[model samples]
Target: MRGIADIFGKEWATPSAVETLMRQNKPKGFMCVSCSWAKPADYHTFEFCENGAKATLWELTSKRCTPEFFAAHSVTELRGWSDYDLEQQGRLTDPMRYDPATDHYVPCSWEEAFQGIGAQLRALDPKSVIFYASGRASLETSYLYALFARLYGNNNIPDSSNMCHETTGVALNKVIGVGVGTVVFDDLAKCDAFFFFGQNTGSNSPRFLHPLQEAAKRGVPIITFNPVREKGLESFINPQNVTEMLTGKATPISTQYHQVKVGGDIAVLIGLCKHVFACDDAAKRDGRRVLDVDFIEAHTKGLDEFEAKVRATSWNEIEAASGLTRAAIEGAGQVYVEADRVIGIYGMGLTQHVHGFENVATFVNLLLLKGNIGRDGTGISPVRGHSNVQGQRTVGIADKPKLVPLDRLAEQFGFEPPREKGMNTVEACHGMIDGKVKAFIGLGGNFVRAIPERAAMEQAWTRMELTVQIATKLNRSHLVNGKAAYLLPCLGRTEQDIQATGPQAVTMEDTFSCIQGSVGLRTPASDNLKSELAIVAGIAKATLPPNPKVIWDDWVGDYGLVRDAIEHTYPDMFHDFNARMFTPGGFYKGNAARERIWNTESGKAEFTTPTMLSSIGFDDAPGRYRLLTMRSNDQFNTTIYGMSDRLRGIEGRRDVLLINPDDIARAGLVDGQMVWLVGDADDGVHREVGPLKVTPFRLPDGCVGSYYPEMNPLIALDHHDIESKTPANKSVPVKIRA
Candidate 1:
């Protein structure tokens, strides 16, 4: 019951805990600030999962980072603390400014912080400033942040998407003419079968298991493909169901689980398509009409080229690359062929790779082959990370502005918005390192720890003229200060958002484009903490020239004004933004692909063939293993709740490496033995992070798993997906060495 004790110890007695439960469990209350998994309309009494509760408790802790707390701790002293230690220091109660002389963060007034930020921003060319967004920002806050960036004459709005779902957006846009998933939340219940690729929905999105369990109970087959078997997907006991919780009976989730090798998603998809093509030829010879010939001829292009590419690929190549037998692939292929409505669900496992764009394209090609697009129970679904990461993109947050209506924004906001694409997350880091970026403002997220090459980026961040973080709690990002760095504390999603007009409720869009209203019912953590809207407006007011062009003050007082601006900006989708958000389950931003209407240059869904499956294994380098970075069951992204990862059978440790027994033997290492991991580099600069105890785990040979941020140092900044600009965190070349 250590798990139960943590819930009660860190949270039970606190006022924040009581308030959090009231706000979270209330019918149609604020959305959980955890994963982006969609929830059903008939909300349960307790809507939160274990991680969601931890996220809330951690955010709403009674412990406060008062001015006195900062006075005692120098930046130098704090730098020695771990991520968990830093977060445990509690909520930032006031605005702070880094004093270089003392090497400490001294308390500063909100006005002083905003004006200083504005002055620094005004001093630089807009092109040199990067306005970054995190998934935590509400729709209103992100929309305002984007507008502020564009009005300031730059579109350098890099967001968390550049790190996670950019590949899904790029790939889906190319083939389906839509950047988001075509399937709705209800489709989970309707789909005949699900083909899960590279996503561990169990730990990442525990709420998602409700649908998976229901579907499994209904005898709907779920095929899972990942490097390691996740317990949540294999069998789950819903904590909400008293009978299941008390009886200790677990529900089986996946009918078939294939341990695909590292970076093997594309090969597996290609192999499945190859088998499908063979079956199609056989059926056509017997006049059985297996392939969706009419749909393919009418609604798609480049099929002949794609078909030839699949047919030419050999089974030996598929087996060697995917680490799956030909019979196994054919069995999955047969399942796909037999299922009338198939939904393909994938996550970062398939996206964070050199061939991420091609990986997603391969899955889309499979869905399109069977006339799955536009069908009720059939389509592509990318399980997005972060609650409103997708919403941030929807409301105009991007380095390269894709799908944003510039003409509409210009007409509504009375300013010529920047048309040139800006720096993405990786590009922004590089820009900072090269001195090209002068100022940086992050709405939320721990940028330093979240990005690769933390050591290099940490040093690069010191050179910036201005660095501002608008956040709720203390994180590692605040420690890496620029010349004029400021930390502006904002109200948490659980707290009340009271403006001049009265209480305000923000909005957010989930993974599938469902917009939900979020209103915080709890009192603010501190009276000094301001809402994100107020903070953005304050900076905009201080920076922008005084004019009636945009009523910044008015928008701050009333969020409905911001919603009005949003509706005025995107009249088609966000029409009646406020009214639509009030609907029982909120509104669904309809996708063009869902209607089978392709808005592509070809006016149809395009079938593109990958050149060739890239090699995953290192035959020449026998001692090296392909490292796949992942989060523990107790963690969410960069936030570490505790040292234990109960789901993986790991306890009281964060540095242990999960390796296959065969790989351990091959590396001349014993289970439970310690070893250092030396990264393989082509640029003559290598990083080593280890002395980590090796734990024997079930995984494909030559593949090992480790928690992210710890393994982030091993990743080179240069190693990334060119099309999506996402870091290739899943397949890092590393070796077990002394």
Candidate 2:
């Protein structure tokens, strides 16, 4: 009903919506922009979820945020509008530049906008310019964006990965030599058990529920550990399942759902390892095999040190840190021990923390004990949120110099690419605040709204000499304009992107490493709007000096040429890029860990010993509570589709906090009472989000839940993982005030 209403409410044509729905996730059709979840090889007629429908309808909306709209509304007035309201204004129909004198955005030609931005770039040091790409961009666009950044002289290419799963890459690269998940969609069918930690699968990727439902029907144990008992984790009635929907029979998801406190993942993981070790010890005495001794001896290292640390840790300490009883931990461990094959899955809940690297490493440690990697049904799976986030990284959108093959890129592009390590999301924010970064260019996202320390970021953002945003709609980031800001509207994933070589199809990699083609079907909202590829090429043409070695126009004209360049840069992975992309269901970019080929320094999977038992050291003060920022069902990252959070029973309101009943009473707070959440970061920043209604939820004591991006303010910019520098958004210290 929500999907239908959203389609009609957006004033999108019914026939267009139907056609889009039919084509979404199809072999030759466009990919859904909602999530990175992989589409099945044998796909159903309707492959998209409700959220996917919302994402499609969102792009297909008939309303337009024309130059006239901006002319009527001043930037100051638009700043007061909600994120939903700003986006609701509709598709950006023209290239607009901020006019400080009039305090409004005035329409400008694409040529003028590109030239002005180019002139600004030429005036500043290329190192000071920041190139930010959102996950929604296609592989072709991202490749061009990265090339443009390097050709202009710096590698300050930071994408959405730095904020979400930077830790996954950092941790997995150190331990297993592969940054991406080893498990493919087929693994779900082969695995005997599934263990989900910290991820709220339902809200993030509803399409994933189908596999879990199938696993449930097979009686496969689906164990879950999270702060919130997400409704999706409990049960889900597949909307497509006619009989089940009619009978109101929902498929059970998690067989055992443990409510681990915020920052308790490491403790629980260690506890599970301890139980496995104890069982192995007893089995050894009975001359029975409990551990995969042969696989461990052949394929793994550092088990001695890792096992010693787990054995040294006491049950009392584990219980205290995990907010779970010893018996419960052992019970979960028993399931892990019994299963022949297990797929350990996690999301941002594990990565967005001060000890995010350690959390991921610890999970890997547990999997290693049973020889989980390199097997058919077993591996580590980090569920990515954005559609092309992983693909962006694969095709060279990285801050770190070593992550990208600079030597190969230099050889392929005929230019000396920058060797200096550029800024990640955190460093970029700090650079802006420190008055070092001068220019900011965003491909497709609300940078100012999605990042942390919003107030500081916005203020620092204004200080930048130039800011360029290539987007589909008006966002808060556009409102927080730089000194010389330009908004270049681009065609969305749902719209046709015709080039000189006819219609083009771009590729995207899913969470499972499957690369599939996505081509738009709907007519573009505006003829003035250019494709992301064209916009990037325009910027490059205007910014860089004339060079025959790099032909920007040719690549933009034929994306296959871009694919050929990508293939040349990464021959092993994208060997037959253009040909393979046209293949039905696309191709799988194989993982090194799956083939037992570890590209690490040790030449084998190594177990890591965590120094800390928990991600955050709780103060245990009277008023202190750990904050877990989450996305409502109606929201995707910073984009709020609707006001209501259907799964959580939140109706027409985002200003509400979910707290345990015990904590509500303990903090002297009553249900439905409006209260202030003051930050306890102790960093001298006055961070507080106000008058939120306290709603009782089934969470562990000393832990509370609230919507993300809204509560992103409470998270200090500096409070992040030392290794990965991913923001510690999952575990923030806060206090409640009436």
Candidate 3:
């Protein structure tokens, strides 16, 4: 029999295999790609993404995280399995706990697990329990998670946002007073120009290709500035449409691509500002308004201080700091200045760093200064991932104190919300290391892989009183067992969601403030598996103060009631949520963002200065490489679907790291040589993880890139954004050793 790697390697040579891969993510019977998961997708679906197809197959595969499977394998033994192997063990059917004495997992009934969980909570001093939520969670499920934690007397809702785009939230709120992208499908198509910073949209958001392709055909220039020259940004093939697929053709992307050095994005933003201000100065001398004159007069503050900073910045400094010449900055700025309307989009490449918030703030500054807010075909978009990630944060998922939300909860629920500032991902890790946090409840995510410091993360998860995961499939998190742990299997996007009343649909908020309805099309693979809402209801029934006519039951039984509650919770926004969702294409109306009526301390979009901390963004040495953490085409986030990164011509291994030929020569290493990564962990700790193979690829000089989870060990749990605590998974210093 062929090995798994060999099987994966062999699949590519077959024409049928190539076609299968091309059609891997075609929009099957579903109306749109977003709803593809709702139906029993043609496994050989009509259309889907490679990663999406892999994720779907992985979820629906014939594997089981059953008691029998866990009974024989020791935690120590299971820890040694490959990520694929662990997940391939199948869906977790019941709750279980670790038995160190036997070195195996022992089955524990649902009732016993919850009773023990309740006991563990009672033992906690309220502040010690960390509630970790993932973006994959449904809005209804998210509400319950927050409610449960809040009722437990602590707002320790350390969520997925803390690790991903939470800094975007912080920066956007400071400027626009809302924390989501302002553009949609139409915005991308109609824009005269689009600016991409610190993000590779092609790999990160495959769905974005549709609009990007349309924009490219219409001659709308898309300028990309990233440290690495991601293949996705340069070109792409759309499998959804047969013309691009059958012809084996791809559309060339990026009118201009600028390869900036890691941590140099802030400098680039500053350069753009200098050019924008220069144009404004030129326009003022000519006695004509290029920027929105009335909006600038009535709205915005700190322009005087900001203008001073822009004028103070020399061309030499901007060029040197950004790794882009003065000419390049002017050339890019010319587009922004000449264009009537433009959209700026970005992702984790900006957010996962020390000054991530600053980078985002700088972009917001550009938009507000140009009076881009409250306008059609112009805005800054922080391209979001997962289904309803933004909605999670909107409905009180933050660990920080939200004055109005707590007050409303108190008035409505007859109890005061927890006053303590809760633990974030970093804080949770710290708490675990210090023994302050005794329990952790992860809603959905490969928490072990997602969190930084692999050794500490693994140790912490293994030490928990309870580590519960509400997941659709077996992941690294499920195997991250504690003394008492639970892996409760749940329904996937393709499964049917049956409530007490009838089948129900879930809702999701896209990158733009568009809220739409989502319903599953396929039947549940197993009868035991529950919907996320049902699981939340079950947990709430098991944990909450047992009120008659439980809110949990009502929300689970009918998602419409959940929408009604959402309307009540966010009256200004979802006033007529039920009636609106019925509209075919759904809704994209978010007033606070669209109208620019900011709900801040002031009532308009504001300007925020960029805060540069170069010391934290890069290595101290001149030649040290700044490596970015990335994923393969067959992967989504940390869920590795296959061994090949087909987009880059890599296969059979996850150990290969991409580097430019120039950087390769400077490192004095061969293409296939294995080397150790040298770096200082944030806590004055020296760390080295090795045997990573070097592969030649298109990346900037003085920069190297590696796939995540494998390189996660090198990330210091303490190396995080100062304000938002998002892990600095990007731009870490490293010296490759022989």
Candidate 4:
């Protein structure tokens, strides 16, 4: 009903929206731009979820932010508008450039926009330019973007992964020698148990609920550990199920849902390991094997040290840190001990903390104890938010010098790629503030809104020499124009992308590493909009000096040539790229860890030991609440779809803070009282955002919740994972005041 209302209310063509939803996630149709969950091998006509429908319909809307609309509104006025209003103005129709004289954006030809951007790039050192790509871009476009950055003389390419899953990559690489999740979609069906930590499945990726529903019906134990009791984690009724829809019966998702304290994931993980070790000690005495002794002995290392550390940690400390009773922790542990093959899944909540790296490493350590990885139905799965985030990183949109095959890339493009390490998202922000970065080029995203320290970044963004955004719609980032800024309109994923060779099919990698092809079916929102591939090629052609080896025009004309370049650069992963992409349900780029071929230093899966009991070193201080930034049911990333969060009962507003009743009373605040959330960062910066209505909920005491990007102002710029540099958006210490 909400999906239907949003579709029709947005004035999208009903038939086209319906048809697009039906084809979304299908083998021959376009992929959903919402989430990274993989499509089932057995296809369904209605594979798309509510959020997926909203994302598709959003792109298919008839509303347009034409040149006339921009001419009427100044950049200063647009800056005062809410993010929802800014995007609701609709699809960008023409290449627009910021006019400082009028403080408004004026229409310009594509050629002029490219040339102006190119001239700015040439004026500044390549090291000073930031090439940022969002997950919305295709692999072909990302490949070109990365290649263009290297050809222009630097490797300063940072994508969406740097914000969400950077810690996952750093942690997994150290433990299993692979950064991506080892499990495929089939693993969900075969796993005896599933352990989800910090992930809200129902809202983040609704299509994933189908598999969870099936698993629950089969009596598989689905354990969840999150601070908030997400409705999706509780119960779900499959809209596609005829009986479920008619009878209004819902399937129970989580068998045991533990509300672990914010930043207490490490504590819970360690406690679980402690129980497993105790169980193993008793089992060995009784001549019964509880642990995977054979598997562990054959393919693991550092277990002795990790086990010692877990045993050394007292249960009382664990209980205090995790905010759970001993019985509850032991009960969850018992389930883990009983299950033969358990799949451990997590989300950004585990990775967006100061100890984010340790959070992931701890989870991997728990899985490694029982040899849970390297087997069917058992491994680690980091459920990503964006559709093509993993794909962007896979195709080499990375800031690290060692992550990309620079030599292979140089050979393929006949250009000496820069080998110096580049900046991640956090570093990029710092670079901009320090006046070290001169230009900012975004492929597709609301960069200004998605990042932390909103006030600081907004001011620093204006100081840049050049800012270019290749996007489908207007966003807050477009308004934070540099001395010179250009907005290049691009085609959406659902719309047709035609080139010289005919229609082109771009590919996206899901959370499971399945490379599924996405072919746009609907006519583009505007005839003036160009494909992301063409836009990227145009910038590359205008910026780089003429080269015989690189043919930007040809690559834009034929996307297969881009795939061929990707194959040449990443031969092992993308071999036979063009043909394999068309395979039904797509092809799985195999994980080395799945095959038990560990790529670690010791050639074995490693058990990592953390020195700390918890990520945040909060001593249960009075008046201090651990605040976690989250997405509402109505939003995807930073893009607000609507004001209502149906799952949490939030409606007609977003400026509400969810808190526990006890905490609200302790702070002398009522449920409907308006309060301010002041950051306790102690960074000499006064950070606060409020007049937020206090909504008492069933979260743990001393833990509160608020929507992300809105609450991002309270997050300090330096508050992030030291190793991965992912902002600690999940765990910020704050005080509530009237």
Largest lDDT belongs to which candidate? 2
**Which segments of candidate 1 are over 4 A away from where they belong?**
1-5, 11-19, 22-27, 615-620
* Whole-model Cα lDDT of every candidate shown, in order: 0.86, 0.90, 0.72, 0.89
For residues 1-738, write the lDDT of model 1, one tens digit per residue. Answer: 345358557643375575566556233578889888775577776777777777777776777888898899998788889988888777888999999999999999988988888888888999999999889899998899999998898889988988888988888998989899999988888999999998988778888898899999999999999998999889989888999989999999999999999888888999999888888888988888667888999899988899899989999988988899999999999999989999999999988987889999989899888998898999999999898999999889987765688888887767788898888898898998899998889998998999998888999999999889998878888888898889999999988899888999988988878888888877787999999989999999889887576888898899998999888888888998987786766689899999999988899999989875752322426676799898988788898888878888999998888988887777778888888887885667778898799999999998888889899988888878768878989888888874
lDDT of 2 by residue, 30-145 (tens): 99998999877789878988778888888888889999998899999999999989998888999999999999999999999999999999999998999999999999999889
Deviation of model 1 at 467, angstroms: 0.8
Clashes of each: 0, 0, 12, 0
Residue 383 of candidate 2: its Cα lDDT? 99
**What TM-score does candidate 4 reach?**
0.99
Alpha carbon lDDT of residue 637, candidate 1?
Answer: 88
- Segments of candidate 4 deviating more than 4 angstroms: 617-619
Candidate 3 lDDT over residue span 126-152, tens digit each: 788888888777666777678778887
Please give the TM-score that candidate 3 achieves against the real structure.
Answer: 0.91
Off by over 4 Å in 2: 11-14
TM-score of each: 0.98, 0.99, 0.91, 0.99
Model 2 TM-score on a 0 to 1 scale: 0.99
